[model samples]
Target chain A: MEPSDEALCQRVAKRDVAAFELLVERYQGRAYRLAWSIVRDPEDARDLSQEAFIRLHESAGSFGGRSKFSTWFYRIVVNLCLDHKRKRRWWKPWAGDAADDQGESFLERQPAPVTDPVDELGREQTMKDLWAAVDRLAPRQRAAVVLQVQEELATYEIAEVLKCSEATVRVHLHRAMNALKKTMKNMEKR
Target chain B: MAKHPETDLVPYLRGELPPAERERVARHLDECPDCRQDTDQLRELLGELSRSIAEPPAVNWARYRAELREKLEARRGRRAWWWQPVPLALATSLAGVLLFVAVWGVGRQVPTAGDPVAFEEAAIGRNLGLLEQYQVVERLDLLEEDLDFMSDLDGLAAGRPG
Candidate 1:
């Protein structure tokens, strides 16, 4: 059986490098995805994820077993992403224009390898748009959307990640959805 | 019919509505083609959005792990000495010494707030003494000329008066 996250975290606190390796392997993809979703740059995503792990190691001794390990881990990712966003200007792509015929050529040239038909053209267009929408969202709203819709985290879990009340998470999601609809409408018009 | 539904659309899209509200909205959606169309569009958008899975590009995990381990080890080495009781005293003393030196250097480099005024007063006093010596004390010829002129004036005034 796989070791529990708490067990791994406990070991990690004691400077167990192997345990940390396991933790990284398990969460690196999610961490990178969250980072990329926020910053919208592959290189920055990788670096941010790595930095999160480094911070995780440094802060391991302080992880009380109050919440799920993923919850704590996601909080770290969110903080790092926010910091990256604050530092960068004009790095994230605009959402609305990716659906033009120009983007079709780009997509064809460099397709994601997840060859399921569901992951094909329509879905890719939407994903690109989704990132654009996320990029346009205010920071808190974006964090809420990413944690809820993309990460599939519940409101309470999102609250933990964002350090806010569940009601606040819902508020952010509501506002973010409104913004997204408005943006997507404009994009469709274009 | 209102252009938009009374209910917030997102919770409804997520199927998070209460039974009474859901029924109310459902009844409204049935009559209002616009609301129906909006719901359908939102559903399609959500469908499209669900495709954003957590996929990362391929990386050499073994190498990455190794490098991370090395970095952690180096960090550990740097901080491990601080945690030890034996070396902590020495480290603390060294830190105190460095701090003292830094404070002394800054103190020497920066004049106190009052020091400039004191310096200006001393410089002005020296300049005034130099001026007095050059113009009055050191210029004996000029002083003697002034004295002779004053005596002549006094003699003329006395001759006129008596």
Candidate 2:
């Protein structure tokens, strides 16, 4: 039988390399995907995910079993990604406009006229628009949506990861959905 | 019509609502076309979000592990180097020396040989006992003079001064 994540985390606290490796192997895919979902950049996701594991290794001993290891670890990754977004947001005004303009033009150039609602459901342009809108959401709101939709975390678990109340998590989801819905309506009009 | 549970729809779609609330929302959805459409739209959007978000590209597990191991080893090596007996001793000694210098430097008021004020202060400190004795001796001399004057007066009274 495989060792549980909690069990492995305890061994990792003791600097058990094998246990740490096992934990990393168990979580790497999920961590990378989760980071990628937030950052939307593969290289940054890989680095951020790796940095998350490094932090885990360093701070494993501080894990007092108050929360599940997964929740604690997710908090670390989410915080790093959010911090990265904030730092990027500072420099974005100078370096971001050209790339964003190009991306917008490219997206606008794509032909996405669908006669049937069912047909629109699977269209590539719709997916792109949906994600583009998701990317544009406030970092916390976007994180909430990703946690709920992609990672399928429960509201309480998301609250734990986001270090916010469950009601706040619900609000984030509500606001994010409203924005995405508005985006969908706009896309439909377009 | 009941209030639209706009806030609860996402949680409802995610099935995170408590059973009673879930049932209530379900019944409401049955009754309200507007809410039902909203729920359906949210559900579709969530579904599309899950389906549309691309998977992270496959990483080489062996390489990933190797790179992480290298980083870990380098970190450990740096820590070990700092803790090695020679370096640790040297660092401790250096820190001790710095602390000693800092304390001594702050507290040091050693008189320089050329500072006249310091020299004078030191000289006065050394003669302090002598100075006190001199004061006592001077008072004793006055007392002796007074004694002589009295003795002269007594001699005059005794007719010895003539």
Candidate 3:
């Protein structure tokens, strides 16, 4: 039987390296995807995911088991992403399309070679649309939506991640989905 | 209580409505054309969402997993060393900060060695001397007033006494 996350957490609190590794394996992809969804950058997501795991390892003893392991884990990832956003708030592209297009082209050039054509195309388009829609959302709404839709966290789990009431998470999700629907409708027109 | 079919449409589309509420929405949708059309669109959007799980970029899982192990090992290794508890660290930091502030405050409060105690003493002496001088000056003024009163008393006595 697979060890429960709580069991793994207990071992992790005891400094069991294997338990920590298992925890990392279980959470890294979801954590990375959550971070990527928020920051919209692969490098930032990788760094944030690693940072979160490192932090979780350091702070495992403080886990109270009051919430699900993933909820607690997501709180770490979301806080890191919020910190990155706040830090980058002052820097802006003063110039127009030249800078914007340059950034896009740079990102395009870095995309890995497509292994499966269909999957690759779908992944690329979905990521593009998702990020574009997410970018238009308020920061909290974006965080809520990403945690809910992509990470498959329930409203209560997202509330823990967001440090808000579940009702607040629901509201954020509703607004985010509404905004996304509007954005998608506009895209469909074009 | 069942919410209006329109009100529950979004949650229903996400399959998040309670079972009874879900049935109510389904039943209402069969009878309401507008709600049915709206539900179809919302269902389509939800479907697209389910279909749109992006493929994660290619990663070297062996390498990634190895790196993760190394990270956890490093953390455990650090924890084993000195084995500092968080509360202890927090207390130590708080103590260090308080000690720094106290030292800083004392450093500011006490006079430094640029001037000797003799200089402070001399300044005190000068201030004391000025105070004494003022006191003497006041005394002299009082003496003048006494003299003027005595003269006035003499004048009154010469004019009124037998």
Candidate 4:
């Protein structure tokens, strides 16, 4: 049987590097995608997600097992991404790192010439416009939305990640969905 | 139809509502065209968002894992060395000594609120008060001179008793 997340955390607390590597392998994709959803930039997402794991390794002893490990880890990842969003202008990806390779925002990246099935769906432009609008949303709204829909976290779990009440999480999701609808409709008209 | 049951949509879609509540929403949806349209829209929005965000970027996971290992190793090297309580304790002791010296030095420059300096100032003020009483002796001397002059004047007025 796979070791429980808490058991792995205990191992990590005991300085078991292999256990930590397992934890990283388990959550790295989720962490990276969550970060990417928020920052919408690949390299920043990678860096921020990596930083979360690094912090987890450093602070593993503090995990008291009161909450789910994934929940605890989610908080770190979201907080880091939200912090990065607040400090820098998402508009200018290359403002600080002039050497940044994937310096474009999600909308600005050049899509492949050939179409994937997802692109073949009537949603290529719709998804683009929606994400562009997501980029425009207030940070809290975007975080709330991503946490709810993409991460599939419940309202209270999202609230835990956001450090707010469940009602506030619901409000954010409602607003994000409404805004995304309006944005997509406007894009369809264009 | 006019009053769409929009409030129930999110929880209903997420299957959060209780069975009774779910049944109620179902009944409402059965009769409500506006709510059905709204639910349809909300579901589509959810689908699009889910699909978009689920799409992965072309990241090399193997490289990511390797780089993280390299960093963690370097970090572990630094942390393991610095985390020895002996060094931390030594640094803390050094800092405490420096702080004590600083505080002690400052205390010497400025006396405590009501200690040595205040008592000395009070003593000096008392001595100065004693010095001011010296002028009272001079006033007594002036009175004696005045009495002598009066006595002489009275003798003269007595038409030179000689």
Candidate 5:
């Protein structure tokens, strides 16, 4: 039988890479997809999800098991996605830097040369408009909506992930759907 | 008592509603076009989102797993000999003590601004090898502060020219 997430986490606390790999295998899909849904960039999502695993490895020892392992893990992934989005939104291209594994500094990685967003729109209008509308929502609202529509998490589970009340999750989803509807309307006008 | 049952449309579309709440929202939707529009619009967005984001593209899980293992190993292996926690902690404590002693030593040498005598005494204590000459230096300093004695020296030098 596969070890429970809590049991795997306990082993991970002892620096067991195998245990961590199990945890990663179990959650990587949700982590990557949740990140992709929020950030909308494939590489960024991959990086963010991997970073979440790295973080889980580091902080595994500190896990008190107060919440379920998935809940705790999702919190880490969601926070990283939100932080990455905020950093990308405020960051300017070709200014400042963060270093990579090889100690090479890279300036902000944004405005990622869409070459022609219109070309993208022509290729997949439905997917493009849906993505654009989701992106238009506020971060938490976007997160709430994505968790609902894509992750298919119930409102209570989303509340656990978001660390908020179920009511607040509902409010966020309501606002996000409204905003998305408005965005779709505006896109049609254009 | 959720006054805004339209908020329930999201869960309704997701089929998360229980049978009773589902029936109630369904009945309400039948009566209200606006709520029906809400359900339809969100349903369309959810359909697209589910088709795309829900079904994430195939990731190279093998490569991803290998890279993550590499990173985990690197992170766990980061401490060189000098970076060992025990030695680093010991070295940090030693440096902290040395720094405190250096600061306190400096504080002792620096007399408060209002106390010239303490400053002189400290200077004298530091150069005890020059004890015999310190009195002479003090007298010379006093003489330099004497304007009349300086003017006499200036007059003498003016007369002598050399």
Candidate 6:
């Protein structure tokens, strides 16, 4: 039987490299994907996720069993990604084109739909526009939405990761959904 | 009609509402077409958002693990160097010297017996009681006049010349 994540985390606190390795293996994909969802840059995602793992190694002793290891770890990753976004925001005007080009490449690599071509194309456009709107959301709102839709965390769990109340998480989701709806409507009008 | 649970709609769709609140929202949805439409729209939008985010590009796990190991080793090495005996001793000595200098500097600022400022401060401290009784001192002339009047009364009471 595999040791639970909490058990592994305790061993990590003691510098058990094997246990740390297992934890990394379990969370690498999740951390990277969550980072990618927030920053929308592959290299930054990889670096931020790696940095989060380093932070976990350094601070594992402070875990204190207050929350699940996953939640604790996610807080680390989300904070790093949000910080990266904030630090990069000033230079984004110059970097925007490159990031968009990377996004286009990623979109092109997506598999084609097997369903009705016309409907899929329309839906695809809508999804693209919706994501673009998501990209423009306030950092915390964007983090809240990604944690909700992509990570599939519970509302309370998102609150723990965001270090905010559940009510605040709901407000974030509410505001995010309203913004996306408004964006979709404007796209339709255009 | 109940006020629309506009904020609660998202939580309701996500099944995050408490059972009683969930039931209330459900009944409200049954009675309210606009809210129901909003719920459906939210559900659809959330679904699309979830589906739209693509999987992250594949990473070479071995390379990543190796790089992390390298970085961790470097960090440990740096920490170890700081804790080594010679460097640790040097750091301790430097810290001790700094502490001594700080104490000496503070000690020099203390007012000594030979210091002019200390003499001035002592003079003020001794006169503080006198300064406190300034109002009584201001009435000294009145007290003197009263004493003279009493002396004259004593002379009259003794049947002496005023």
Two-chain complex of model 2, DockQ on C-alpha atoms against the true structure: 0.58
Candidate achieving higher TM-score, 3 or 6? 6
Worst 10 residues of 4 chain A by lDDT: A98-107
- Against the native complex, each candidate's DockQ, computed on alpha carbons, is 0.18, 0.58, 0.14, 0.28, 0.30, 0.46
Per residue, candidate 1 scores C-alpha lDDT tens digits across B1-162 of 544553346566777667886777888888988877877877766665676644556667677667667766787798897777878989899999999999978764443567988677656765786665675555887889889888888988889531
Answer with 1 or 4, whichever has the higher TM-score. Answer: 4
The Cα RMSD in angstroms, rounded to one decimal, for candidate 2 relative to the true structure is: 6.8
The worst-scoring run of ten residues by lDDT in candidate 5 chain A lies at A100-109
Candidate 3 docking category?
Answer: incorrect
Write model 2 residue lDDT over B27-92, tens digit each, in one string. 999999999899889888888888887677788878877877777778778889787899999999
Candidates ranked by DockQ: 2, 6, 5, 4, 1, 3
Query: Residue A98 lDDT in model 3?
Result: 19
Return the TM-score for candidate 6, rounded to 2 decimals.
Answer: 0.74
**Cα lDDT for residue A91, model 3?**
64
Model 6, residue pairs in steric clash? none
lDDT of 6 by residue, B1-162 (tens): 999988888889888899999999999999999999988989988887878886778889888888888888887798898888999999999999999999979865556788998888767776889778889877997899999999999999999998
Candidates by lDDT, descending order: 6, 2, 4, 5, 1, 3
TM-score list, all predictions: 0.62, 0.74, 0.61, 0.69, 0.66, 0.74
- Tell me the tens digit of each residue's lDDT in model 5 across A167-188: 7887788877766666555554
- What are the Cα lDDT values of the candidates? 0.72, 0.83, 0.70, 0.77, 0.75, 0.83
Cα displacement (angstroms), candidate 4, residue A38, comes to 1.2
Cα lDDT over the full model 4: 0.77
What would you estimate as the lDDT of candidate 2?
0.83
| Model 3 per-residue lDDT tens digits across residues B1-162 | 334455456566767767987788888887777777766766666556656655446566667677766776787787664566876788789999999999978864444568689568656765776676897879999999999888888988889542
Name model 5 segments beyond 4 Å from true. Answer: A93-124, A183-190, B1-3, B6-8, B12-33, B43-48, B52-57, B79-83, B106-162
Better of 3 and 6 by DockQ: 6
How well does candidate 2 score on lDDT at residue B60?
88
